[model samples]
Target: MTITENAPAGAATGADGVEHVDVLVIGAGVSGIDAGHHLRERFPDKTFAILEKMPGRGGTWWTHRFPGARSDSDLFTYGYAHKPWRGPSIATSEEITNYLDEVIEEDDLKAAIRYRHEVTAASWSSSDHRWTLDVLRGDTGETVRMTCDFLWMCQGYYNHQDPYRPEWPGMEDFRGVIVHPQTWPEDLDWEGKRVVVIGSGATAATVVPAMAEKAAHVTMLQRTPTFVAAVPKTHELAVQLRALDIPEDWTHEILRRAYIEQFNELTRMCLETPEEARQFLLGEMRPYLPEGYDVEKDFNPGYRPWQQRIAVVPDGDIFTAIKEGRASVVTDTIDTFTETGIRTSSGQELEADIVVSATGFNLSALGDIPFTVDDEPVDVSQAVTWRGIMISGIPNMAYVFGYFRHSWTLRADLVSDLVCRLLAHMEAKGATTVTPTLRPEDADMEIRPWSDPENFNSGYVMRSQHKMFKQGDRAPWTHMHEYAEERHTLPAADLDDGSLQYR
Candidate 1:
């Protein structure tokens, strides 16, 4: 493991090393690291580079240095499968970011990381089967169009764009500072002000409780109720088990497995039997609210549990905050923003000193890049997800994306191992490039019916559902809701294949 640290403190880098690499992995997030690590493992002689846009690595971790940002899922399943997360049960944004840094350090991946080299666009040449990337370095203000054999897009949907703020009727009239949880403004002071959080997703859930800890009053505004699920890191059995000679690594693995197993089944149940799922979810939520609070009205979502993402409360801590009157959930759609507060559709205007939009992210398809095949434009929008790994008709391009239902890294890890297998298959067959085309059966788009409907709000699902790479079959094939099953599909599989057209 050799890490070459040439990146000085800046946003971009200029022309320096123009050496040819076999693969160019864009975005140095969990996906990018997997791409590089897997590529290096499968094709030991092949060279790859991770071009990160930020001055440093850690995509969302670095970009979103928000005050109360943390993982909604357990940290055990959040990081690289090879490297476990050595932090508290629920990892803070700082912890996850630091873990990613540690991954880079442990694997010596920094040498190949071209930090601040933001890729603007990628063009693939058909005759040469190579991708030419136009990248801008933040520090040097230098732009270079580098060439590579294959393009591995690890840039998760979210980019450095401002969140979408709807035109609330009197929003422009509000004198207070309006903020989106995505692009947080660090210097803003909300010490003792009344803060109203918009939307009912995990972001809002995360912000409200943490803000209530400091703010005078934190109001969580929701158009529809969001299903809240609370799971503790240590149950009675796990607590007793941890006291023995059980290693922290093994303990985390077991906890990650157990939680993923439960969430996976819960997601499937929500999709298959929505009403039953709703009833089950409400059963869990009812105990958190006070007397006379309608579970169906305040906590029951219009959709099934996984239909929209079930908000993780981390031991029902957020509900406790609300239970203690530190936080309140107002179930109403925002009619508009007033100078002093937000007015709901029910004609009630609440006073607020600050308004935060936790309204989800736009479908950011692989860093919003236009992919080309053999110099001709290959429409990715037209492709179907080949088990959510490789795109049809496009040769040697892999995209790393995660499930909204399960941990993001679980799927990424699968794709990483699959990439390794595909590389080995290509090497054994003496093929320069491999494209996994969709079988005739997967030509239509039904979304496999298992993927969390919240993905509809995700940037990838919004923009690229029409793509051939979108999974047709849900879990075990296209979707992996469990860690144990994913291990069977990923790092454990053989790379030999008959799907390639050899050179």
Candidate 2:
């Protein structure tokens, strides 16, 4: 690792030819964009640059090219707090990327972003109060170094390059094409082919109906059922607000708040009266299914409502495909992969020409980047998160990990606000470094998993729990709270509460 002298603020290069900035943001995704916007708007004198691993902006949207790729959360809450989302509630990846493009162009953020630059390792020097990042340029194999006073990690929580694909029995013997949604092949044709999608999550819910459009038949094979709700493609209130000629910003805020309230109410209902919430969720899908279709066998989940994420089917399109006989659902465990297709444990063989593993993604801890503090390697999983943003023992670094029950961007925006506030506070104190430290009172606090499995047990979270940071039983140490609570608590969080050590 190359160490250089810390350059003054706003200086692009230091004496040793190392590029330096006030802040270095990792990833140009949703969180990164929001961070960039807030830093520019709140602190115009600060120099920062967004380093994106992909060749362009729209991190996940640009990376995921699977059919029917869209957001499970409504765009109103999923979009940036500053930008107005004028599109429908459920939007495709294209629409999302387009909206992100508008934000990039309108804010003149193109110049501040360096695309195709991936950060391999980040080393922080306490002596100099700066972070040195070893970045690799994708277009060229050459490696470059950049230093920053503060590191804003917005690379998201999942591995974009390597998705979680389980090795099934006889996968090598399968003659049909097997594809994972994260890395969809551009030239692989699925039209007029029998397709079988494994897993019943949002990706499967989206892909099944989409492939059914031209595929001979699409089968959604799942080991267990998931709570699926049919939401309107366009929100009713959004239509009314637009009809009244309300300004875009006003509509965005109104819809954003409305969705937050609705989500909170549903969450409360699920927690307080789980049986009623379960029945209600199941009842909502009954009308969308074909007559005589066994909803309990396929749509009814084993767990209570909100235990995991509920997949939202826009306008009941997946159900419509099932009703039209273009697609079908099979709830069973896979025995093995035959030369033709998958053979379920029930001894039934379903032949297919293509198989899509819409299972899930591997959770990436801090973009899977190696880190070092004062030349000593740091293991992130051993550290605890401070307000779900900064990690314990790491100085001048903050990450954006969003809420699972609500839209990810909602917390992203909140974190941006908190980070900006923290930066301003640091400036006011004339402190060059700030770290979330364990207080004397916190030493005895119970250390828990990053998220309580009982509260939210999504497959991705459960499978990767060992790789995530831990949370404590106290305030500012816990991070898995709902957005309804954090929306206020985060803004009002005391920075000088002795939880953070500054110098």
Candidate 2: misplaced stretches above 4 Å? 1-11
Instruction: For model 1, give the 10-residue run with minimal summed lDDT.
Output: 2-11
Give per-residue CA lDDT, model 2, range 414-473, as digits (tens): 999999999999999999999999999887999999878789888988988898899999
How does model 1 fare in lDDT?
A: 0.72
Best candidate per lDDT, number? 2
Looking at candidate 2, the ten consecutive residues that score lowest on lDDT are 1-10
TM-score of each: 0.88, 0.97
State each model's CA lDDT, in order. 0.72, 0.92
